[model samples]
Target: MEDGTPSLLDDKKRTSKIARLSLLSLFNRFGFALNSIALPLFALAIGQDEAFYGVMVAAAGYVQAIALFPAGTLSDRKGRGAAILFGGIVNGACLFYLPFVTDSLMIIIVYALTGVGSGFTRTSLDSLIADHTKKGNERTKSYGITIAVATLAASTGPFLAGFIIDPVAFPLAADPLFRYAILFYIMGSFRLAAGIFGFFTERWLHDNPDITPAIVEEAEEEPDDSQELNGNSRDDLITAILFGTSQAMMGISSGMVVPFLIPWIYAAFNPDPIILGSVPAVANLTLASGTLFVGLQSERVGKIKMIFLLYLLTPLLTIGMVYIPIFLVMVGFYVIRMAVANMARPASNSLFMGEISSERRARSLALTRVMWTFPRQTGTLLTSYLLSIGIMGGIVNFGRFFFPIAFMLYPVCVIPMYLAVRRNKRIVEQRRQQRELTDSVEVP
Candidate 1:
């Protein structure tokens, strides 16, 4: 088939699927942002400390990591669409129940359930996208577009939630708990809609003749053991572990900012929720814009090089956050940081998908997610306790201290990432050489 020619699915059908996927991303992110905006405040409202909030979030992360691999395995065996739809429904149900529960333990239970749903939906959705696209550029575009849409939705969600929950503006709407509850209710409805849409969409691979079930089955059965044979000597399993550990570390770094940022801003400057929402909104918008650039230029830039460059810049951005004394400056620094951070995401994802075999892709992706979430939650829990002890009493002083520590750790983190990338590159080259040798022998 020509590159520009439409598949048997037709242009309209393909477009529809993409649209549904985009909407699904949007809704999922909306729910995520809503929870991010509300959860810490919910803990405060229930008279729980910051440490409790951290623990709650961490529990959710742990659950998500645990569920991700199993969910991916199921999606591989069953259908991706069914797995995603089922997960979405479960997520919606959890959100619906979230508002009604006041007990901390109950809240933790609900969050953990949501994490399970998250694992199912996200893992399946990514795999489905991979299954649909044959071209590398197209896959990158798809991921970039999906992330951009999610960022836009996330930006909107927090702003709306903040406006609704702001005590001064709404006066009567000052009930933070009720406002948060309503936001979750809306998010649940969004999830239900996405789930229904997912249920009706046609199978991604079925429409393409080039992607025969027999071919996929064959690929799955013949596990690629080239990595094991090559003197390259580095195990992908070990690399994956290192990658996951780095992700956990990054998550911890992020946790230091997220759960505390709003409350810190509130305590120091007493800004309204709307103003508080602006910080993340700005960050999300920047991220979206950066992703759009990546989508347009990805084919030209070469994925790995672009990702490496972006990754190197991230720690500097994090350190920059420490120097800004004013709130607006901090927001600006954060926006820049997020933009740089997101610029690397699509490339990293493409690298990951390209490196792994079809059968192992799901588990590999799950492993990455586990690393990302688990460490973040652990970091959040620890940071909350530290913050509770009045460690970060002053903004400038705290930033000066923590930023340098984070900066010092950045190079250490980069070493693992660099090694992994090199190892993957070598593996790809080895695979290419082996394929050529086999093809040459077969031609005789």
Candidate 2:
């Protein structure tokens, strides 16, 4: 494998696997989009309070945290296929039950189970994709394509909900509970489709095995990453820790935004389903477009530089998300915000995973997720409390006040990433200089 242009589409096996994985990602996210809308709204309608809705939203994080480490351990030993299949099944089953669960606790419990399943499915799907692709450009492109498929598919979900059942209809609209439940049923169907895709993708990949071609640039002087003693470089640990912290902070604020954002917009502006649906849909489509460009350019633009710029812009977008007064303007800002924040994800992931030795990749990934999980739950709780108590005055608009604080938190979170990117660059330069010195001495 000399240094030449590598094409993922050139190989039949790789092409087939990537296609299946893309489809799997597409279905998985489509359900996720629907849940974003239906689950929180349903909880709010049933409980008639923001507190319970927050708690219910938090329940998924709890289960995901609990399942995270185990799922990783399982995937490393038994392979990712079974884990993903199991997760899809569990996720589908839980969503299917959501429509039937009328009580708050039951709603929380079902969502918790779905989160647990997601822990298994999402991590494995991620690791499995990483396993299949070549390092550097291929991996970045694969991730971007996979994410684009999923994002674009998910983008349709809100639109689908908007189209199917009008937010303001006759008898069904009269009862918020019944109106949202219909959407729940529709989301469950999407989950079922996702489960089927997961199973099929797994089986399809296994039935056809192909050794992924190694790239010239990625070859190592060493035998295997697993041979290292406990794959724990201080630099890697620091990177992971900083990355995880940034993710957690972002997650907390994001947790506050995603589940409750639509409901908040509806109350504040009273937008129709078409309007409501368009917001998230456009946001995701924007993300998909940005992701494709990021993938294409990240190889040349430099991943860290791209990520740093994106992180820098995040706080401004968060501010925009909070204070934009007009309905359509807010939606426009949200799309840009989502795109800016998420477009760098694959590149950031490439940087992080490149640091960890293969042996500890799963464990490191699992550990990092813990930092994100706790913060997300806490954010939801805090936001719900603010909403419940009317801390800033208006019942529906208290989030407006909290938005500043959350947006401000973005700066704090990004500090570590800034440090990591700079530090990693310094270390790489030091390594290059040392290598040159060794080569010079040897030549003499």
lDDT by residue for model 2 (1-444), tens: 543334433355666666788888887787788655555455545656656777877888878988988988887777777777777778777876777776657777887888877888777777776766665677778788888878977898877666544645334465566666667666666666766677667666666655353222345454232121233457667777887887887778777765676777777787766667778888889999898788767978988678768867876776676688877788877789779878887887666666555655666677678778888888887777777776766435565665545655655676676676676656666666887899999995
Whole-model Cα lDDT of every candidate shown, in order: 0.68, 0.71
TM-score for each prediction?
0.83, 0.84
Model 2 misplaced stretches (Cα beyond 4 Å): 1-10, 167-182, 192-196, 199-239, 418-444
Encode model 1's per-residue lDDT on 23-105: one tens digit a residue. 76786677677655576666777787666777777777778888888887778777777777887898899989988887778
How close is each model in CA RMSD to the real structure?
5.5, 4.8
Model 2, total clashes: 0
